[model samples]
Target chain A: MDARSPKRGRRRHGRFDVLWFLGVPILLIVAVEIVPMLGVVWISLTDYNPLEPDSWLSFVGGENYSRMLGDDLFWQSLLNTSYFALLYLPIAIFGAMVAAILLNQQLRGRLVFRGIFFMPVVVSWVVGSTMIMWFLDPSSGLPSMISESLGFGRLPQLLQDESTAMPTVAFVAIWKYFGYNTVIYLAGLQAIDSALDEAAKVDGASALRRFWHITLPGLRPVTAVVVMLNMIQAMRIFDPMMIMTNGGPNNSTTSTVLYVYRMAWDNLQFGYGSAITAVLSVIIFAIAGLQFWFFNRRSVER
Target chain B: MSVEAKHVQTPSRGAAGEGRLGKVVTYGLLSVGALVILGPFLWMVRSVVTPNEVLYSDSGGGIIPRQFTLDHIKDAFTAGVQPFDVYFVNSLIVTVIAVVSNVIFCGLAGFALARIEFVGRRAVTVVIVLMLAIPIESRIIPLYILASRSGLSNSYFGIALPLLVTSMGIFLMRQYVMTIPRELDEAAKVDGCSSWRLYWKIIFPICRPVIAAIAIFTFITAWNDYMWPLVIIQSQDMQTLPVAVGNMAVVKDQLRWGTLLAFSLLSVTPVLVFYLFLQRQFMAGITSGAVKG
Candidate 1:
């Protein structure tokens, strides 16, 4: 009451302002986000498809979820997503850390270097992934053309092959997204105390020792953030996979979200799609929650 | 804080400070990284202008174009199977609507959260944060149903609806507004300005930095978004740029690549131009995230 006593005039108009401001965004969020989310849960329990009115559109009680157990593509997509995560998580995190460390060294024209490095982050995924695909197209693309001209045989298809497709698309995504991670890491590096490094140098500590002790520990908080962001993004690797590989070459690069997209959009299997999405929501929720919980526990100890 | 402040003031720590060998190593590594980062865009540019015969021939992959032509660029606009012009206009319309909606809606919500002591404010903030956790993938099924049931499917409004405002935009704006001195709000009150007038005259101008940042983020995201547009616009005539490009990418053809690359480059040119103009603001917004987190 005491805190509220100083501003009675504004308080009279506060009701109208609240209705104007908070009401609109909250309603929009509910309509688009919150409602659709709950709708997914509701729709997942049925055998509903808007396209097929003749098909019984009634509650089937987890039939869609049960069906997923036998669905090879769903499982395969998860496996593919896991394979991608294995490549994406470490490379994206470590690549970004190294780039951030390099860019943070107070180097000349680091801004220019940073700007150049960050260019792909600004590019649309449809364009960026497609560009890489063009450069690597086995028959007519650069590597094969140049190789054949120099008396070498044709280069193998990186994208159209089962073995290399996932990794190649992973590389494309890493190239596009690493800059975002690097920028975050750069900020984390700036927040670290330079005085600690200077003191370590004065005490005859090696640069390696200074970095290992001070810099690495200083980056712990940001490391968790980058890891969490990449983990979630890696699982939902839709754009690059869809644009570059389309889960082709024996479905090597099909990601979970891409699978959801195909099932929901292409096949018009909204119920089954909602079931997949519900499952996906749980997995992502668990991953993010677990990481934050683990990181927070460690952070508390630190 | 002081070290970071020093960094902002003078962003360098130096080449001369290190020995010649260190300088050589750093510059060499930095240059390599930059080239690697830019290599894809360079390939796109080279292939976009090169004549198709040379581009597809044994000598196709050369860094320099063997023969130059403007026909491919013309084809990207006037000659492609998909109407690149329609895609361009649709994409522009969608992006403009999103940027405006996000700015106005999120800005109002952010202002209320930061400056007004409304009821359930804490609960609302927590809910907004929670909303960020719900992935777009998870919402796709019912989002589709919602679009069609609302009779907006195959329309621009349907494609841009889900993204008109986002939790991140609201959160970012709120954080920025919270940093602005509340004294301005109090002074505006003393001058008998209404709450909307206060926001317009005092808060809105002060919030320009964050406004620009959010608008740029919104523009880039709305411009690049492929999935929603893919689902919403069923008809080819109404398809956005990314959808058209996505379709082009799926076709397993070797001959039409010049057209493909040209369209892709054309789709990305506006973003590059916008970014170059606001590069400072763009990068600042990126760094702001990690610092706050």
Candidate 2:
């Protein structure tokens, strides 16, 4: 019995060692990510407010979701987020593609130019937003100064004005990410065989013709990645809008994530906030799934 | 003869050279693009050094500032609700702890997934990838509740906990660990090394590059993180640099442009400098992470 028990204990020790390696991370992911996700789902069904310590566990089913259905501000914010994404996706994709092609050339100082372009990606979003705020400030901003010198009047306050705030924010978002996309596309570009371009040239094809027929098609996979990532990222736009406009000038720039922040923290409406979060999460997942399926199918067909 | 020479030059230029004019155009376009990209940062640096009054003056808005002063830098460090030093320190503490936790926990987790034979390893990897799809912002509400419920809110641990074991870090480490030879493990085991010792002595030391990548990425993400920190940390004293700078902008009655610029500069300098030195590794980390994902 003593020998048998010792062997059994050794077996148990081996199992325990495996758990020791995997346990902490699994527990962390459960505690931090998965559990919170489930909690968010549960919280959406309740009207519990943390500020009121006594009523922390109260439940009200479907009311927050129903309220969100009737909330114009909620819809407006969602639309604003979509608008920002639509504006950003095309510019980011096209600009990154073009810039990547340019930088991929065998120019004398291309590396220096690549570094200069990629500077904004390394800068923090908060800092970039602040810099944008200052640079577009009507009183003494560079844009305003340039406009005045060029015989144009003082430029409009882009951030404060409702008509331009979202687009302005979108532009800054594009600028911040353009370099990152450029680098990714450059990676894609470099992977393409130079022989393909050479063959097209041998066929008496012009540079534009070669680019249109050969280069663009070769970039399909990378383009799919860039587009999917950009769309998902743009949909979750929060930091720039939160920092720059605070969803202001008539709620023009209030992204859905920012609205979630406002609902939960600013107003202490945890139920409503989680309701929006639940819905937004589903929508984001759906979009990502659709992109994945589309990309996967295309690649499979190719 | 001249016509034939011109014809030959034209075809060769079209094939390879793109000509002097083409070179001129390419350089011009690249220069303009660079200017657009770096223009705001230059303006930011100018505002940091330029006096506030001059920054506001119509004629004083140029790439180069005429008057220079350190008053704004001084004010940035000294003149806030909680001074900038406190914010810097808070950010430093949170980021340091986060980096350490990520390296250790993710290193262990990654080694197991890559090398150890265990049940549910596949399930764990699948879970990690799935978690990557869940945006942190969507989970922030419940995370905040969890932190508050556990009495972790407003503490350094609370700020760093959610970020301690990022899925990307685990995935990165696993990929790096998988590239290390299996023979090393066998060699270590032959010398009386246990699994834990194999991981610690053999695996960990060889993973300096991946560890460096994880450390840099985590440091930058933690330092620049605004939303989660804003939600979790409510105290004036516990605020990180981004949160502090954001609050300073909103709460302060007078927007001190120079001071704000200086503060922005201070917040960005560390990561920017780190990025410059380790640019290749940073880019490799990003690209490799994306490709693997």
Candidate 3:
């Protein structure tokens, strides 16, 4: 594109007028993403607290970083966030692939089923988390009702139990997010050269064999995308913990983002919050880069 | 590059779908998945119609309500945890305005990036891509500080500002615009079209598919956004639906479940409406934006 564009030179009325087009977007990006990003990095280094006087906002170097390292909750939240990513990644990627494959099968009312599956993708995590909290509430909710109906006593609290909370939250999160990966996989499925599968079939290849070689390999790009974005989102998870558990039942569900929000807003520990944010930003960038490179290399090797 | 609407409209390969047993298995599995997916949302609708007493009563064998009532739904507006109507209007205003700005700004920017030869063009693209890599949640602290400092806090513009023009929208438009033949620009220029006119007339009209993609994506993102609105909006009246309704997180009494459930249903209504009206667009837009990107 670089070589061809210069050779084929896009002529116009001096093209300078178009610079303003770039101007507005660039301005907004700088203000919203760029400025705040720099601010976050700066604030992370200090002991700034909104409630405190300006004197308290003095630069404290890497004190916030050392504090974060010493903080037990920071480590706990990091682990919880990592746990969430581990729980979310495989199930989400695999489930979406299966759902996509299922939807691709010629079935009655496939479009309606597509809508049914994709319903969660449109819903906010707020709506999802709020509804899931009630729907999964221990005693008076659906779980207990069904348990009692089956001659078992009331079901144990799902969200209230420390052991079950993270898994429960991750499940609901998966329910809300899997639809997106499914759509992506469906698109990837459609994008595959169907003639390969058809030819494989004509060669008497079994459905499993065809799917294993022709389908799965063909889906590498979307798979890379799905896995990378899903992991990043899971690591930065907030709504599930914030709305559902409030990082409670022994703070088991306290994800890193929820921890950041807690420190920054709830506890007014702005510096520590920004420190965590800076760390998270770097981690997200690293994961994204690794995944992109990994996927590109795989594609090149193939 | 998207191949969204046309390809999804027909299954290009469905050899297994042709088998009789495969049809049964497919429908059966899809039905189970559908049941699991739709269960909570359906229960939400059911709870919305059920009165508080019935919702709390032992007579209910399931989350299903034996009787239906509109009282809870009505209370969602009047007896909200926050100023429900105000939040609804705020979300509506913020979402609509943000979506409009996304289209205009991203349209111009996308066209510029794709077609116009300009300085810092590649740099802008790199920056947007890098922005996309950074998670929004990680940046909320500084976003809040900026919002408050700029006096956008507790204001609709504040709520909408950060999201007004998205990196995804810009990238979606840029990718789509790249597909537009340079001849369109050439011919338009030769036919007395200025740069702005070339964009407004030639590129803009041709970019409707991606525009639909951008519009729907931006609308959903803005409408469904919670973290930013939760951070920026300070006043009770300024809360968006998600923040407002979501704060009703604790219906610990179980009897108060109906109202919160009603609020949940209320907050989700607009999104459901979008899904119903533009079902394919939702699938196509999301598929292309994520997959192609």
Model 1 per-residue lDDT tens digits across residues A24-69 = 8989888998899888888888877776654435888989999999
Question: Residue pairs in steric clash, candidate 1?
Answer: none
State the lDDT of candidate 2 residue by residue for A125-204, as single tens digits. Answer: 88888888888877767888888878897789888888899999998898888888888998888777766676567688
User: Which of the two candidates, 2 or 3, achieves a greater DockQ against the reference?
Assistant: 3
Ten-residue stretch with the least lDDT total in model 2 chain B: B8-17
Off by over 4 Å in 3: A1-11, A52-57, B1-21, B61-64, B81-83, B250-253
Where is model 2 chain A poorest over a 10-residue stretch in terms of lDDT? A4-13
Q: Docking quality tier of candidate 2?
A: acceptable
Model 1, total clashes:
0
- Name the candidate that leads on lDDT: 2
lDDT string, candidate 1, B266-293, tens digits: 9999888877877777776644544454
DockQ-wise, the better of 1 and 2 is 1
Better of 2 and 3 by TM-score: 3
As a whole number from 0 to 100, the lDDT of residue B76 in candidate 3 is: 73
Chain B: TM-scores of all predictions: 0.91, 0.89, 0.90
Ranking of models by lDDT: 2, 1, 3
